[model samples]
Target chain A: MDFKKITIFAGHYGSGKTNLAVNLAFHHKAQGRDCTICDLDIVNPYFRSKDSEEDFKAAGIRFISSPFANSNVDLPSIPAEAYSVFAKSDTYSVIDLGGDDRGSYALGRFSEFLTDESTYDMLMVINQYRPDTRTPEQVLEIKKEIEDACHVKFTGIVNNSNLGRETTVELIERTREFADECAKLLNLPLVMTTYSDKLEKPNMPNPFAINIMAKDIWQV
Target chain B: MAEKVLMKGNEALAEAAMRAGCRFFFGYPITPQTEVAAYMAKHMRKNGGTYLQAESEIAAINMVLGAASAGQRVLTSSSSPGISLKSEGISYLAGSDLPAVIINIQRGGPGLGGIQPSQSDYFQATRGLGHGDFHVIVVAPSTVQEMVNLTYDAFDMADLYRMPVMILGDGILGQMMEPAEFPTESSRKLPAKDWATTGTKGERKKNIVNSLYLDPAELERTNFERYERYEKIKATEQKAECFMTEDADIVVVAYGAAARVAKNAVLAARDAGIKVGIVRPITLWPYPSDTLKEVAKTAKAFLSVELSMGQMVEDIKLSIDCAKPVYLCNRTGGMVMKPDEVLAKIKEISGGLK
Candidate 1:
């Protein structure tokens, strides 16, 4: 799961991309690469990269947490620590963007610094089951909106499709064609299909599995 | 005409309002409901309509009152906390018998509770809003199609009774996208603004749109007249929808997004050979009480589901007004209840009767 020097994850909220990014961060760190993960979400602080600071620290992964002492404030504060990704060219960094266009637009401020820099991948995560992206057309519209907001092109697409805890192997299998339709619309490569299962199983379409960790502990 | 276009509920409802002859809008921006004002800002000016974002919710609602007093169709929208601030002005509109539409795309709240979707404001909406004996006509919509339908008709109904009308939605309904079709402009019907405060020009007689009455007896007489209008509205304007309710012994009652979840649970329960149905309240204030009371006569029990701390359950009991075991299945503080959990409650309640 070790990616390019800079890997940015973008998707709507509850698309399960945050958990997938967390898994990829630890995977890169375990592969003996210097890794950093930063929370680029100024819209919603819940279920973002900042909430997993302790776990990232345990794995020797540097985390750029939200600057606000109160996470709920609508302050547009992008941490200065996040710019280390642009400076340190060798660091395998993953950025968890805000859940929507409003959150994703923060990347536009750093567009000058992110110009074709030393190997980067910005993948738009698509979950077919999410209410906002029920169709391939909708997914394409969201991708265009994010591109318009961030002024950065999406390099690839990731099919992190699942129905929360009710996800099944067959459900994931059903999502493959939907993901393909979206990928074909954007002419982008399908990166990987992620599953919450940690097992190595054959006969499945793809095997990018994650031991899910980040969750809202405050949720009732 | 364009067949159907994908739009968020907030935007769709705003478009519908404009098509319904509402040429004036005043609202403050708030979470999960800002799309309405954003859309209005982009298009209201081009359409020869007036769109103003007030300094606050208080200022917005009063602007609505002012524009409506001039006999112009006007609208305003906000979320839970913002709606609370507008309640004082809404009460004033009710007292003055002015017609206006106020959309509350609800969010979790008691005091700036959270930005997530919730249904806890049923009490404040259906019961008297402020310090007055008045009721705003509350309409609850479960889908984007209904959001368009209800918002298009809210203005007409408000004018029909010369009272305040509310489109009580939640964050999910406001932010979620779906296909909606707008009514043809020619098909729209609006009463003439003859009662307008446009310069009297010494035509015949001046019109006063004030809500104040100095004498105690006069105030009491004005209230009686208002109650007479409310009674007429209640008799003719109750709306509801029933799903799989023909032969079901257990009924699940809910509205808005909570109704969406309950509909899924009822479908799953029906497939498992359990007789269950869902009764969705479309008009929540003049709530579908008569229909619910009739359905209660045949059902074994009633389960009123909500995304709040069990506020609508009180109305459910009042509608039936019986000992027929009207129970509650609820979640609060921005938590959405899952289908399996609600299904389990259905089984548990039905099991007790056996």
Candidate 2:
């Protein structure tokens, strides 16, 4: 639960950031803090943070996303209420950014406010199993791309390597070094390692348990 | 065996095509399927292939035609509306007997309908993708892993039959993540493209790739020959997966994302003591009529579940020759049918069964 006032999750497409963002918001809510989560994904058409709107409302956490979210219409427009994350100082805001540099362009709207490094932590969620960012070099390239798009440097890294529903603790353990190599290459602090709540918690540093929320109803 | 990796369906299909020896990819970005083009743009060049984001879907399909005419494996993908724009080119590809692969990650549609998952393109894909007496081999895959496997197979099939092969999917199948192991290499030994428009170098006759046969008798002869190839393909390549169809009184027919939901519903129905099973068609063009005919002999009734307004129901009726009543369970315009709804329909159909 130790984090900045504003935490941003950004990474390659399908890197499990939306799930992590939801879990982090709930974690802060459990600690009796006023938490708000924002969904800034315009790149992906499905399986986004907006899908967890009902869950956030049930947990008494404010959720901000596109008005056309979860609808047949797919617009890249973000809501005006998203700026409240920057304006509100007392509330804890966890922003679930869209994947890749193109997706990061939405974050650029609030770039002026994100300049205060003490208040915001942009964490690049790296999944080694993703086709686009499998190597440390690939991870660094994405980090730079995201930074250039949003004009905000990534403050830390989160190793969220997994093979969708097939993720195992043993798989996570084997992929730890890839995350470590990526963090070392980027010279960013390895913030946390995430594992699905479906699995037993593994013995790893900064373990964050997440529920895969963004999925089709029929997905097992 | 390669390690299983988490891949979005669009990316997986693009990778599968690349590994299947597809070196030319011309595409236009559309919702629910842009990842296929984006992935190709990022990796196709590094894999020693060409990835061009053409100005429009029409241009993209024509680019596919050019590459395919050269005897190179080519790919072009888009959503429902984009596929409509590519229809003219698709017809040309079929008319010229060019082998190419097309991916249609369907969205709700008549015209610019919506971006959510839909199987409404069933008729458009299987019956009439373009205006011609030709049929494209349409493969409908429900899972991301199947998306990969089918895409790889599609290229081989397109080459073997000298026709376009389409992987007809919906938004859900295009956007969802799943663990899939891509084939490192093609499983079949592909035949050489002797008919390709490669330079003759004055050694032989120059090959002409054209569909315009002005002579009426010649055109009729060509059409007959094409239908003969189609008949041969129909006999050899009809695929369907029957889940618990043995001795079931009620059989549900579905394909693509709808089949996934129907399977879950069939499992739920079985738990409630209602004898229900599912017939999932992998090849939509050939229609998998033989399997349906075989299941129809034992099954008392049929249910066609779809994400459209009863398009596949007609196919189910024709496949079974209407020996038994085939009911339709459907939702349209971006709304997918729920398993509970399908289960209720199945239970109702089971109760009415004589």
Candidate 3:
């Protein structure tokens, strides 16, 4: 059995953090592992785990949210339930943080939740199409902004660049290379890559595990 | 029968679609709505289903269109800006008389608006998302539980009417985690799809699914046919949940997340010795006009509470014939009206009655 570990995903706006978190949870769940996802996003008002709670429930995956997580315009505050999840030594947890620098601020509150060398993998998801994060250098700058705000080191990266339904293998490869280079430069592992199921298997040699989206992962 | 588990609105929508026999989903990541796509992606594959993270909202909707054309239960979701991009596809889906599900967990918007929840898309959603004459079935789910239940109804109505069904949600409803009992595993059944394009074979004629009709006369005929279907849908699918309105003197009109806020307001008013009730329209497109008209007859005044400045208020007035004073209580650009704010409006309007 794969031992339960905490995976934290962070990224810029439209960086596909939720996508990675949901996919990772599903991947673990498919392996007969118990997984819980806590949506800690109080920023980037849309595309968080809270939106698809029903689906998670049906899949026997537990979902946690903060108390102030509402649809109204207020920024979300991390709830006690989130801290409780992190406090636990057992059970695999994935925290899908919000997008943008605000996400970094949100991550700062969970500092106490991290334990020393606790096998927590902090992944920075990069989508090259979004502005302020198109190039590896831009991603590094965004990463620096997040690292500075959260005071946490990013351990790895995930490349999730795609041009919607028209995304081609070339585009995926280009993104993969960019992320790989960033990972190499940062001396971190290139954790995984994601592709819309619309793409046929690419010819490039796989250097990392691939996340093939079967559907909206959060929908259950 | 299946066991019931507590669920949130986003998750409930996924479960409801599954119950409706939905097997295909495509969507881009957006807040207050990412859960819908995430939920679908997680389980669809296990059930021998298809889930795709399309490149954009446009691709996702078109993917839904393609899958729906194949006679599969398919859905796509997004928030405000994403939904705006989907308008063209939505119009096309409506024009083609295709059955699919689209969800909009609304946020403030004209362009790249803040992510905070807002209901500013009322006019955009109900007034027709895209060009030409067409209407999609729009269901407003105020709670996480209703999000699930109504999503089931959305697929049913969509297929029944051969139109796209939309779950018009706000950021609050999409983001909040609440307890809800979900249907048991065994009780969920995939609906029959005789109209899908899963390869034309021995007994069935070739099925052509396209929105383009170059012949004006032919297009007109299709439009009339769709209108006829919409008429039937409007007559049958007008749904609203009335709370404490039976003997109340004041009726508050609201829907989606605003309805929940309004519910609290009504409860607070009742506590303060005010006889106020709420009429939450679950089906925004149908507008629940018949019920609102009935409630308007007895209520001294009707207050429309919403997150948008006053978009849905116009709908309320038009639906109820503005017989009584139709007052507006609203917040804009991702701001939500507090319960006290709504009660103050109710009190102010009630004072006028004296």
DockQ of 2: 0.67
lDDT by residue for model 2 (B78-106), tens: 99999999999999999999999999999
lDDT of 3 by residue, B147-241 (tens): 87777777777777778888999877876545454454323334566667787667789778888988999999988887887788778879999
Q: Which candidate is the best by DockQ?
A: 2
lDDT (0-100) at residue A40 of candidate 2?
Answer: 90
Q: What is the C-alpha lDDT of each candidate?
A: 0.81, 0.90, 0.77
- Output the better candidate (1/2) by TM-score: 2
TM-scores of chain A across candidates: 0.90, 0.95, 0.85
lDDT tens readout by residue for model 1, B1-354? 444555668888888898888899999988768879977986799789999999999999999999999988899999999999999999899988899999998888789987777898899899957778888899999888789888878988888778999999988788665666676653345577666577788885777888788898998999999898888888988999999887889999999988888888898888888899989999998988888988887888899999888788888888989647788998877777888888899989878978
Worst 10 residues of 3 chain B by lDDT: B181-190
TM-score of 2: 0.98
Q: Give TM-scores of the second chain, every candidate.
A: 0.97, 0.99, 0.94
In candidate 1, stretches whose alpha carbon ends up further than 4 angstroms from where it belongs are A1-81, A87-105, A117-220, B185-190
Interface RMSD of each candidate, angstroms, one decimal: 8.6, 2.0, 14.9
Candidate 3, overall lDDT? 0.77
State the local distance difference test value for candidate 2: 0.90
Per-model TM values vs. the true structure: 0.75, 0.98, 0.65
DockQ of each: 0.09, 0.67, 0.06
RMSD (Å) per prediction: 7.0, 1.2, 15.9
